[model samples]
Target: MVEQFQNHITPDSQWSTYEANVQSYRGLSMSAQSLYLAVGAILLGLGDKVPFFTVFVLAMVTTWYVFFPVIFARTAVVDFHKFNFGERFSKDGALRTAREDSKLSERAYANVLGGRRLRANVASNIDMPPGQNFRTMRQTRLKLDVFIPASMTVVWCIFAVYFAVFK
Candidate 1:
């Protein structure tokens, strides 16, 4: 199976696809954040001209209804790629010997391992449940992706309530 896979797709191509998925995840996440900010600004600017309830509903719908689903999907894709690459490239995987035989210098190999460790560190969160050992890069990204929009949504709701009660 490994030979068949290698025959059909080189490690380079698989890595490239993984990198592309990571880039797409980042682009989508940033675009969503920008959209939230833009929508909030536009609605807030309309202040007295538009009903506060309308602004609140629009903000809630845009973040939760429109963006959350897409974010979830993108996160899943990136996670899949990350896991696939790890499984294929890990020490026990078929590609491990192939990668080890490559002409990378000792320093370069060390750097590569260091980079992997750094990515792992970045993925791990203190908030994670106890006894959960492995941490993937996607987990960290998923937290940020959901947390930012959730925070924005909460702020919008607070503003809406304040306006409804006092303004």
Candidate 2:
């Protein structure tokens, strides 16, 4: 397991990590939206049965607090890397990515899920301990991930309440 990501943690890894994170975050956000829509459909369809409004309100709360933050955090991290190190991406990136992947088995330890687990896996892949960029990536990824979800929760909760109470 450690051996798999041994090359993704060095200062040189910033670009690869950022690219991986950007791609992962996009998919995660879409998944969050899909989950929200699917669950909302099921709950709304219930209508008068099982106190559906209450169920929706609760589900929205969870999505706000739990689901969306996960996606947001990932986005913030990639955005930071892109903002500060935009040049890193432009120079020989595609070729580098191809070269990096050609090695295989020593890149990153990814799974069906992406986030903290993946960060740790990437860290473990590096030769030395993480530097400023790596640590910042993980910290922001952890901190902001939940913050965005909070706003989404509030907005959705308002929508749910409007329909349940006013509509």
Candidate 3:
């Protein structure tokens, strides 16, 4: 499989398919980070008027909104750091980057450009598996499912608590 990947990735044309994901990394990461962090801050701010439980519930809901996209963004970063550039994503599935030492099955890779072969480029140039979009309308739309309830959970918890107790 590794050999197959090397063969597939050797072509420069396939590399073009991944150009958007690779080039757009900054915007995608920034957008997701901004959306969740900003919304998280807003959720936290609304906490004061609501009950402690409500705040806690909001925090939990906030976790969902803040969590998955972060996982996606962070994974993209880590995945890219170990990015084989045109190769399929890491088979290991962890954030592990390419080895600096020529030890994986006695195979070693080093940057001819970076002087001192001991220093490796590691996992920073991973490409999105072909036919996949790192950032897309569908993925963005899915946020509605999370934010809808994640946001509503906060509102519902607030109103429920208010009418049940604060009323």
Candidate 4:
């Protein structure tokens, strides 16, 4: 049965569709980051009303600590989405570019997953850059580490707590 299925399947050259969850989570993170920046600004403006120093400090801290990383991280992911995976694999320069981009993508995923500890897995493991070793589908975005949204969420939560409890 498996042999028959394999024989029936045609190999087509097309970019595989990304899961909706992948895009959605990235969108959500971006939105949350924007909101935090906006609201934190407003709160800071109103800081004169109560415990002036505490309020101002908390607002600034929340803006810097919480909103900043989310904005940068999510923005990078947005940049990730902008990348043409197909271009990366093209005969022109996609292979070279993709290999280099893969290292960045790998680092982003690593930071989002097991933290810096996963550096060896994503960064060092991908050091060859295709000239020395062929690029694989698993290296592109198939790995389980692709979802760094979870890590961003954790950072977001910690910042939110600081805002709620102290601000």
Q: Pick the candidate with the highest lDDT.
A: 1
**What are the per-model C-alpha RMSD values against the true structure?**
11.0, 10.8, 13.4, 12.7
Q: Which ranking of candidates, highest TM-score first?
A: 1, 2, 4, 3
Give candidate 4 misplaced runs (Cα > 4 Å). Answer: 1-50, 85-167
How many clashing pairs does model 2 include? 4
Give the worst 10-residue stretch by lDDT in candidate 3.
102-111
Model 1 ranges with Cα > 4 A deviation: 1-50, 85-130, 133-139
Candidate 4 accuracy as lDDT: 0.40
What C-alpha root-mean-square deviation, in Å, does candidate 3 show against the real structure? 13.4
lDDT of 3 by residue, 1-167 (tens): 24345455445443354444444543543455455445544655565434544544544554555544443343333333344422332333223346532222112222122212222222332245877644321354356434543564565456556645644
Candidate 2 C-alpha lDDT tens digits along 17-54? 86686567646654665566566556655555345555
Q: Which wins on TM-score, candidate 1 or candidate 4?
A: 1
What does the lDDT read for residue 45 in candidate 2?
A: 53
Q: Please write out the lDDT profile of model 4 over residues 1-167, one tens digit for every residue.
A: 22234323232311112234445544654565566556545554565334433444454455456544544444333323344322232222223452444333322431333333332333233336565632222343332223343454455456456655766
Worst 10 residues of 1 by lDDT: 103-112
| Displacement of the residue 103 alpha carbon in candidate 3, Å | 12
Order of models, best lDDT first: 1, 2, 3, 4
